[model samples]
Target chain A: MRYVLFLYAAIAFVVLAAGSIILPDWAMFLFAMALAKGLVCLGIVAMMRGGVVSFGQGLYYCIGAYTATLAANMWGLSDIFLLTLLSSAVCLIVGVIFGPMLATYRGIFFAMLTLALSMVLYGTLSKMSVLGGSDGLNIAPPTFLGWAPEGRDLQTALYIYVVAIVVIAGTLMRIYFDSEQGLITLATRDNELRVEYLGASVRKVMAYNYIFAAVLGGLGGTIAVLALGHVDPEFAFWTTSGEFVFVAILAGYMSVPAVFVAAIILEVVRSFSNLYFPNTWQLSLGIFLLIVIVTLPNGLGSLLSRRKGGKT
Target chain B: MSAGVLEVRDVQKTFGAVTAAKDISVSVPKGAIYSLIGSNGAGKTTFVNMVTGYIKPDSGEINFGSRNIAGLAPRLITRLGIHRSFQIAQLCNELTVEENMLLAGAIHHDERPSFFRHAHSAAARERAMATLERFHIAEHRNRLIPELSGGVKKLLDIAMAMAGETQVMLLDEPTSGVAADEKFPIMDLVIEALRAEGVTVIFVEHDMDIVTRYSERVLAFYDGQIIADDTPDEVLLDEKVQRYVTGGPA
Candidate 1:
């Protein structure tokens, strides 16, 4: 059954990629950006499963983006793979440094602490002229192992690259969600005391989850910066973090694939609402969230499960 | 105290002006079913908390098998062969009973705790199922936590702790929320299971019948002090216990 689902996902991804070749350039760009944002939602889902709702994942996101952009500008390192590795490594270090503080909080305290940290980053980024300040830095177009795309081919390459990365991430994430650490992390959300009593270190587990979330956030930001060709202070803003949270809630922590679906849905909704309502996109999102909260408290992921009352 | 597997000496804790525990000392022998009985606010739970390393005493020594573990983290204490079941039944409300059991089994038995290994590895699943079967909760293994009865939840709570290398098990109000008629059966299964594993069991219970029926040794607490400590019959018959605890000699 699992293999069949994987095969189905592969076929769907192939279809999506094939379809993207014929689609308009703007649509392809939007799709890539959505997939990039989806990566951030994946991290949010992981943290939420561990009883944490970070309001500052954008901190790591911004860090990842800046690290990639800065590394390119300073060291002339523009390889996609190298940038991904560097971003993840930098975020892991940041996560470890912040792990102790994150471990000391839970619930709203954790949420607020995370928000404060992100705001600090935003404030710093906005003031640093070397980083282009509020204007931020523009990232050089990335090459795949030395093969740089030219003009129209850039969109095609990026679109395919994102699809492949999202697929790999989604597949790996599914396995992770089924792994021992994932189960324990999810269990901690319900009862930290019981988890501790069972012989697992709650603080250690939270730290691990925090780092994992940070790595994901960093990866997502790296992808976003590469796709958009720009990295900015606004990427670390509380509202940006709130947007990730919004997608996570829309996606639910039930399954890994939900994150991608939620991100795409969010982007599509935002684009349509921005075009149609102009001034009421936020209002539209708020209403959508209110409805999801009321009708499907577990988020859209619950819709995939046939088992009633079985929490994902 | 030489023969005791778990020992507490001169433990004292005070929250503000209220003394939750004062000069509390007790020794629990290996493979013994020890019960602590007291009224509400009598520091029974506080004693359990201190022993389990949930709360640190201002001054005391808690030695589990020769190691002084007074201020250790709860996980370290638990890893040192002491496990606890909460009074309110601390469990993963979003997970199934078997999942909870498997989590306990994996944490307690798997030292490396691999991220690659599936949580329900064959060994873990079998162990979880066996533990559930031992507690007569096999029927509810697949059920979500909130679906189980209070008696079943209480039993599962204790049963989950059995997954660990439990040399000493502390149970706080094991039968508190359970139905009166189902209490003894749950306690009987719990005691039998622990005895089979040679676990030294220390439980804080308010029910006199449970204390008398299950405990080999009973410690009666009054005003944050052990007013009586003896065999069940002797502790139950003490005048201090009679007046303050049992409301008169039975």
Candidate 2:
């Protein structure tokens, strides 16, 4: 059954990767950006499974973007692969330092603490003119390994790159969601005391989850920076984190694939609503969210799980 | 007495002015079944809590083997082989019966849960099913906790506690919310299962009938202290126990 899921994921990856051949340049960029945001939301979904919602995930996202941009602009590094690895490494270290302390909090306290941490980063970044304070830094087009692709080909390459990362990360996350530690996380959500009495450290499980979320958030930030060609303090802004949380709520905790789907849907909706409604795009998004909440309380993922008669 | 598996000495716990446990001391022999009887707030649950590391005693020693586990965390104590069931059945209501059992198996059967291995691996599933079958709740393995009857929840609670390598099992009101007619059957299943595994059993109960039937020895509590410690018949007939604990004729 696990192998079959992996196979399905591989086939989906192939189909999505093929889209770069037919999609227009603008559409490619939109999809790439959406998938990048989806990675950030995926991290939030991971923490949500452990029964805590992070309101300030932008801390890692901003850290990732800044790390990649500074490496490129300051150190003259241009390899996209190295940039992502460096960003993820920085986020991992930050997560390790903070995950344990955050794991000790729950519910609203956890939410507020995470938000506060990100806001502090926002304040710090806004003041640091060396890394481009409010105006931010623009990223140069990146080279894939040693090959540099530009124009439409560059967009296509990036789209495929984002798809590859999402596929690999999503598959690995699905496996984690089915593992013993994963089950323990679900149990912790229901009754933490029972989990502790059963001899599993609830805090340890939560801290590990937070760290995973941070790395994924960092990866997402790197991808977003690569596609957008800019990095700024706003990456760590509370509103930016709020958007990730919004996607996470829309995706639900049940299905890993649902996260990217929700992100793409959000991007498409925002684009069309802004184009047509212009003045009321936020209103449209608000109404759309209300409808989804009223109809699918567990989010878009539950619909698929309900049909399959099992949790993904 | 056969070597005591759990020894509590001069344990004291106070919540402000009220003393919940006052210099309480008891030695539970290996493989013996002991029952704790007291009114609400008389410290029966408090004793269980202190022993299970849920509450650290204000002052005293809780010796499990030679280790002093008084101030240890609950998970550490549980990992050290002392497990307990709550007065109210604590269960993961969102998960199915088999999933709940599988979680217990994964945590206890393995030193640490693997990140890549499935929680419901064939071996883990088989162990979970065997434990469920031992308690006669195997038929409800796929059912959710809310779907089960009170007695079944009680049974599953004890069954999960026994999933590990336990030397001592503390059951806080094992039959509290169970129906009167179902109490004996649940106790019988629990005691038999624990005994078969050679686990030392200490249960808190208000049901005198259950206490007298299952416990070879009884400790009667009143106002945060043990007033009588003897065979069930002797403890039930004590003057102070009759007045303060059982409310029986003196």
Candidate 3:
């Protein structure tokens, strides 16, 4: 495990060095967004693996973003890092508390229940005048400690991005999938009765996964809000949650890196299409999603596994 | 590991106005293969659900091993060494077989929610593989649950339960829809694997031959009550049990 970490750090150091010299701001932005999106999707992957399809991740993401916003503005906090941690703590608490209810449901109902919760959050947030009501609040330039964050907040964003990508996508999740509880989550999904008799509590497993998803969503949302310098009730809206699910499908559920790659590609496509076609880009996006769904049953991650198996 | 004893005392359950289970009490000791046989709507599933902590009984108390586990969280019961497999295998058809094992593995992996703690250590993977190998389908480790045959999927489903490495297991009709020829081998494998590990199993089934073959004792549920609870041969010979099972003793 330590060796994997060391290797990861070495590779990241090399990439950051390369990015600093070669990539432009736009490319860096894409990378950062992709990484954040991937982490968020990974949480969804965790949830989905347990036979759940949550449409409420947007609520966690928005909570993460606004909690940081609330921390920075209400408390005059200077450390962006601390705010990130603060947001994560909040999401974890909420996830652990409400996750069981979500886990109790299954199939389309599960999806709808998550969407309903997120919408409830959105409705509540939109009504709060203190949260800038409908217009949303301007996010202040977040500084790390006392150091006036260097070179176009993008660099700061990029740094946070790299950290999120490495930690969120690393061997922890890989090893988790190998662990006893991880296997139970799948068992719980496949056969709750079997899991129960085996002396595993499916509820606990599902709750933990849901909480993990919340933490990831919160982390990603907080960073994205800080990057965009604004957050609105829309952060909790179903559409945002829907977007995460859509991204998960595009990347397929299992591939952690594919999710990041897909996120960047989605953003790039949206940006380029908007620039070129203006109005019909959504159509293009829909078509692309359809293609992936039809072509890849397991999504992009299956390809990597299939290749690895073939080589072996 | 704490004696693997399960005690349910005077447990009564009502769904709104309908009585699902009534004054039911049974105790399963460690290292016992207990079989529950009943007709449809006999409350076998309901009884198991209550014990698993999915639903609270209107009355009575349940002691799992030494702990009073009545109406506790299902996951908590699981942590205390109780696991189950549904009648038709309820796996997430979308995930790979290995990934399926993982969802359960993560929680049992540690007490903390550390995503950074790589669960894919040599120890975890080897354990998961060993679990699959125990079920005799380790070769199909990479296949998706939906792609496997009903028998194979059933085996994998049981493998997921084994993933938690629990001592007590609950199965609902472990051989429900398989070819008749496959039933004996499946039960044989399940019984052998679980017994070799010293795991106790309690299952519900309509197959009398299976009960006679694998169970040390037979529990008969009729109208939500255990009308007959005894050694398989004893239960088979009892007049009332004969009436309940075949309308009259042959």
The candidate that achieves the highest DockQ relative to the unseen native structure: 1
Cα lDDT tens digits for candidate 3, B150-221: 888888777777666576788889999878999999999999988988888999888888999999988988
lDDT of 1 by residue, A1-312 (tens): 357658967986897789566978888888888888888889888888888899999999999999999999999998999999999999999999998778879999999999999999999999999899999999899998999987768888888888887887777777677778878888888898888888788788888878888888898899999989999999999999999999999988886777888898889999999999999998998898899889888988888755347375
Q: Model 2, stretches more than 4 Å misplaced?
A: A306-312
Please give the lDDT score at residue A122 for candidate 2: 93
| Higher-ranked by lDDT: 2 or 3 | 2
- lDDT: worst 10-residue window of model 3 chain A: A303-312
TM-score per candidate: 0.95, 0.98, 0.76
What TM value does chain A in model 2 reach?
0.97
Model 1 misplaced stretches (Cα beyond 4 Å): A1-9, A306-310
For model 1, the docking class works out as medium
Runs off by more than 4 Å, candidate 3 = A1-13, A30-39, A67-76, A90-131, A149-181, A230-238, A306-312, B1-120, B125-244, B247-250
lDDT of 1 by residue, B1-250 (tens): 2399988999999999999998999888888889998889899999989888899999989998879999898889988888889899988888899998888877876575767677877878998898889899999887888888999999889988878778999999999889889988888888888888888899988888788899999999988999999999999999999998889875
Give residue B77's lDDT in candidate 1 (0 to 100): 90
**lDDT by residue for model 3 (A1-312), tens:** 567645765675566546645677777766666666667777888887677878878989988889999898899874777888899999999998888877778889888988898999899888889889876777787776666665655475445545544454444565565455565565566666655544455677788888889998988887787767789999888888888998887776555557666777888988899999899999999998888877776676767554333211
**Top model number, TM-score:** 2
What do the candidate models score in CA lDDT, each in turn?
Answer: 0.87, 0.92, 0.76
